[model samples]
Target chain A: MNVHEPERRLVTLSDVARAAGVGESTVSRVLRNQGSFSKRTQDRVAEAVARLGYVPNRLAGMLAGSGSTAGAKLVGIIIPSLTNIVFPDLLRGANAALDHDGFQSVIGVSDYDPEREEALIGALLSWRPAGLIVTGLEHTAGAVARLRASGIRIVEMIDTDGDGLDIVVGFSNRGVGCDSARHLLARGYRRIGYVGHDITRDLRAAKRLAGFRETLREAGHPLAETEIAPGPSSAAAGRAALGRLLARRPDLHAVYFSNDDMALGGYFHCLAEGVAVPGRLALFGFNALDIAAAMPQPLTTIRTPRLEIGAVAVERLAADGPAETVDLGYELIAGATA
Target chain B: MNVHEPERRLVTLSDVARAAGVGESTVSRVLRNQGSFSKRTQDRVAEAVARLGYVPNRLAGMLAGSGSTAGAKLVGIIIPSLTNIVFPDLLRGANAALDHDGFQSVIGVSDYDPEREEALIGALLSWRPAGLIVTGLEHTAGAVARLRASGIRIVEMIDTDGDGLDIVVGFSNRGVGCDSARHLLARGYRRIGYVGHDITRDLRAAKRLAGFRETLREAGHPLAETEIAPGPSSAAAGRAALGRLLARRPDLHAVYFSNDDMALGGYFHCLAEGVAVPGRLALFGFNALDIAAAMPQPLTTIRTPRLEIGAVAVERLAADGPAETVDLGYELIAGATA
Candidate 1:
């Protein structure tokens, strides 16, 4: 029961070799599952490893400096928040791709804090990961300097609005906003309102809002009302925001939410409040999340290439190509809500 | 632009020391921000590091055998799936806890595959993480052996149905099922049915189902019907499964779903099909997710302490105590649905 001793002696590769009655190199080969080793010798080494409890220090192997294992088979990934389904979706894609290529991910959640992101970047960098994938282009000057000087393959994902430190794989957030506004406009819904979570922390949302307002202004129909929830996006916040927005601007014909989570809340609000979606009040959202489609009346939203961005970021990192931006693009889902 | 040179020379601590006109020890001390070092020396080392792109290898530092950095400030966390918000919420809790303790997490997704879990365990083990956190108590023999032999702390989370390898932190899934069934029975709903996703992969769900069935049989009601979707739990799958369950046995007075995601789907189905919930058919679910509370008719479900389980697991790992099971009990939310 007392498993947590202060300092238990670690089992070494030499211990495995000694137990197996084989050379240290043979034990190493069997443990790495690399180099030439006979089946009998492999079985012996495995038995010794299990018996001796030899957990190989892969860091030592990397320090030994074989060409293939020169860099640790690890990728450092920093995302804004895990609460939003979007980041998880991105991580799922990146993890799958990295796993396929025999790499593991060390993850840090920044919680939309620039200073935290910088600290996470430095912590992750100390591990000497093969590559680093960060969420956005916006970073503190300290973070940017550290990333630029790290000399590892760096990938900035989920937004393609500005210059990137290295490889950038994502669609334009502003474009998604502009397209969403156009879709709502095409549906002949004017006097549009906006309901969203905190945009200050979510720079992408801020960009989208800018583009949306710009498009609406050009059309001579500016946003009628805006309700910005104080914290991270949630269905409850979305519902309450929609309620508050509706109470303030009852004449608004349509509502554009920051993302699908907020929009789902808006839809639920409509359902609970006896407001006919699209008939009484049109609703539009971003990120065509699965739940968005599963709703009784599907939510009209912009489907960003979240998974593709993560996957392609890893792919580009592994490919080790030139520093360039790859715009995977986005799609507009014209569901019943709009 | 051509960052992908085949053999880019790596900057070393020695190079930083040479550039800064300081000893390698001073550079190391400055990089770690540990030990006694002058502010001027720290500035010099930082300037040199920035100039030479020197990424201090923390692994190498650990190998050098400093007690403070003896074991890497890393914890390996392996979860089943990322698509399910439950896992993210758990990860968020664990990550927050780990981050607070100055540890980063290396994550792997087993995708509910035992073989994959074994592989991921082996992979994570090579990193020599300070501790390991895996989703369930049920693991392959290989994984169990490796975990037992690893000698470091291991925390198995989110289910307490069976014995764990080390520290176990979670509520009993079977107990959740029993309580849910009892709640429905108390609400005067007989002719009950069950709808779930592939329980063959999700062992916890299988345990819950077994408990639900046993409790129902004890009450002399028994399960009226059952419908299981072929893949992972999803809103779409849940909605379709509920629809199919209803079509097969319209006389069923109540239904229990795998979790809140499925329950939400069923709720949406009721909304779409105009099935009067708790009037004609009562719906019960597990895992009182935030969305479950946000629903118009709040879902009747068990609120498992997911965040608490994760945080407690990390706390137990850090505490380095005796191997023990910590049962953070679940709460039965008596909502409007059941």
Candidate 2:
């Protein structure tokens, strides 16, 4: 409830200093564990603040554009889904940094929808965040307009292939895709197909697919058949799509999926139908999610640096002036299935 | 920035009604769309609201008791984690209902920690939500005490097994677990084990495990070995946990997982390691998430009514008279895995 009855004026650093019989700088130093201060003075300041129930205003710099304030410190983060593990990891990292700095994060969920990204840019602008971090470079007309118009610092995350907004942080989806294709192809897999869901929504997946296709084309071979589900990729859709694809082309030797979720489904389909993985057909996926490697044979995939992107974004946002992009890169994980 | 500069008073619903030359009741009805009104009158009300930039305060009832004219309706939502899909589905449903009522949802992530729940409840109380929808009935002493003291309406969601706070809306996790056990038993699988991730933190998963064990014990057999990952359930952890379990006890014929994520992991493991599902080992999981059914050999799972639970909680809050518990119920899906 935003009950407008004026709250009692909070005890400020000045009040704490006066109560402690010390200078404001001395009180600040003791609280921040920075400059050397007498033990007695530190205890006095601590006691004064506790007695006054003084919660520090952390966002001083952000709100005033000067001095140190915890609440005003900016922390930027980008995630594929607010409702997914990838986002949670990002949150964990950003939260750690932001909370430490007395900064809070304003997040936007892309929903894997580029149009929504454009809309979110406007929503985030109201807060006048010190910095901005977004999922990828793929943006709708409205999103690009606001991102360009909004003067706040920016960090583009997850995929670092395209032109950045201001600060770019993440790995290359296309490179990960190419690596996956080469690994599977080297295993004597020629009749390779692809199964994915809503590559149109997930620009990163589309990039990976493009890279995979480029690698296949260079090898003088084209993808045998591709199956795509209508909406967000899920294990069930992956299984259903793969089942249909295999039903149409039963002799397919290998298949590279958009992500581990789809590849997991394809694996399940093989498990159910008595078609051995890597024996009759090889399977590969991206985002070496925990389950991918945990699988019996392990999923050969790429591990994106989700949490680091968040942590680094916040770190950069809290630094000096104007923004810049940073690419953290990704890792190639070789599991049993590939 | 919490600027202290003076500004004109915000336009209220009464002003819009006056400006539109309509009765106050008429404005309320039109805004809520609860009663029948002529198109001409509706258009007038809409025009006046737009012209004045009137933001409706859905806190009419609560504001009557408070002294200030500046209060926003608080819709408090406490979820275990945003990482899982189930909670997101619930959140989306709640958001749809709350948005229409001009109520903003303030969320607290408990991270499956009861202590965190206690802390979050304390923080949420400061906002003074008109209603609170918390996940599950189990809570720490401090949390329960604070909630009881708040006197606001409370809704315990995602399970209806234990004593509720004020209102409870969810299905029975125990029933879901038992039914899964029964389904596997009916499929003639004798040797069974349980695979899950951190049941200690997730009370609902623990309930499911309890029911599964109880049913198995009633059926004249006990679990072979329960394998649990030390973290949140995921396909990767499920795969790893299943692999380790299998290596320890290769003769097990079936395994019941805490939820779909873990089950998916186990399924992937089967594909990677050349384990035959159903033939060599059957897999069962809870929460028939989208991917569960899409797998090539669909997984046998208990489908939870997630969206319904969320929507019903909001509906109960909007009714706003007394509180009670609701058991929405769950569905058992028989897929090829079992």
Candidate 3:
């Protein structure tokens, strides 16, 4: 449980060059090897560097001594979670663009905690990153204030309908929900239930549910029953919730899950219970994850452009100023389940 | 894309103090506010920090004033993948232990690339972490040499059979596979087929397959067929693999999958085709993931103590240098499927 503290001496390249008895340019050249330098100079510089135990300051190189007044080419990205494949694909696309432009990207996982997100922002800001990308627009009061006054460009991702700080990049979750409701209604399914997990934490899911209910009300049909899980949505929890819902409302004709994970659980439940899918009950899900399409009756769900959202967020950050909002639309993959 | 380069020199703590006409330590204390300081000092420090942008260096603070001596408190973790739920559960357990002891953990993902693992090791070493918790014992030549020479501590996690890199904390994948075969044989299910992703990338899965086959041969029941996927295991790929395997071996009595994802896909495939599970073909999986248990008919699989592995790995790294090996056994969960 020992906290291994960091070394604090500001050992500059000048000190290494002085110790090596070489010019500053010679030391820089030997270290970076970007310019021509004699082998002897390289050896001497290496020896001095090893002796002094100097770690070169990449930030200093990017910021200091530039005639033009431009900040360092760095971007900070913060995501809710990395356990899911969605965020990784996002990182992959953003990494490709950042690497191409020689921009260093520092990432922090908030684990869907707003306080943690704020703390992470403080850490990321310490590097003075040129731009910042966050998972969603919902933020703590302190977090919002700091981000507002930080003067750096900001980009909120994954949900675009919220009031943005500067740049917004994502799709409309509400629209996806309305579309899901209409699809289910058109199929003559009147008695429908809703299964979700922690709707408050995932604001987008709440919006989707709102839209779904609105559409149902307009059509003279109401949701059969709403079941909410205690925590993060998992396939197991989804299955259990669906089982409970079915027990309570046996007459339900279809179910709209908050996302694909829960819907998959519902699908599995029906299979285990020997209930014919679409004949006894139809199923719908969101976030057309890979598993959804591979299901026995492919899950009818909405596919968010996760990778594209990440890539476009970076591209917008790289633009001259902050972008107001970029609505990268979603896709509704019609599968057999619904 | 024009990179949104900032147009200003980043203000430092020293600049802030100078602007406020105060000592650097006073500003630091006021910002951190760990100890008592006058209200005037705090106000002046805040004003100075606001006037001149200054961000604290967390890395520098953690290391400042600490000498070159290594501490035995840190448990560094390196996992190959995060997409699977197994690793996150492991991290949760490990973090609980480390957090209780006031220890901080730093982690990196290898993405199944040995070279990337080696590079990540180098980056992790810069922090001078006390002990290393690597994924598998199979490391590249350079990585092995560096780890051996690093002289801190090493604990290879999630596998125990092959070789030892200091302390090994996991069960034998081969043993699990062999046991699975015995379970199926006792039930009179023969003409078995195997479905798996790239076994070479995941050496553990390969070992399991080998053990399963060996057991089957010993029992005079050979594998009728196997469907090998080209890349990482996914539900889509698993579904496709199952379809191909069934098309090739329609008479197969049972099928064993690399993990729960593949098993789930196979289950979905059977559901879609109206293939009676157990009556026609039984399905078995590994890891006993949460979803597997929640499935309509719980997945018949081996349950490895993934979270306990993580907790024990951290404990070993903190308590002892390394052991020859530590065997954390596996379990067989007989669900309705098999």
DockQ winner between candidates 1 and 2: 1
Task: Please give, for residues A201-264, the per-residue lDDT of candidate 1 as tens digits.
Answer: 9999999999998999899999888999999998889999999999999888999999988998
* Candidate 1 Cα outliers beyond 4 Å, as residue runs: A2-9, A16-54, A66-70, B2-12, B15-23, B26-54, B66-70
Best by lDDT: 1
lDDT per residue for candidate 3 within A130-233, as digits (tens), equals 78999887999878867765667888998876789888998888898889999999998999999999988777789999999989988999887999988888
Candidate 3: pairs in clash: A5-B62, A5-B63, A6-B62, A6-B63, A6-B64, A7-B63
Question: What lDDT does candidate 3 reach at residue A326?
Answer: 91
Off by over 4 Å in 3: A1-27, A30-75, A82-85, A92-107, A127-130, A318-321, B1-11, B15-54, B62-77, B88-108, B123-133, B149-155, B219-224, B311-326
lDDT per residue as tens, model 2, A47-98: 9976764534332313333222332344434456644456666766676666
Give the CAPRI rating of model 3.
acceptable
Give the per-residue lDDT digits (tens) of candidate 3, residues B170-236.
Answer: 9999898899999999999989999999998888899899999999999999888999998888777
Rank by DockQ (best first): 1, 3, 2
Q: Which number leads on TM-score?
A: 1
Worst 10 residues of 1 chain B by lDDT: B62-71
Estimated TM-score for each candidate? 0.94, 0.75, 0.83
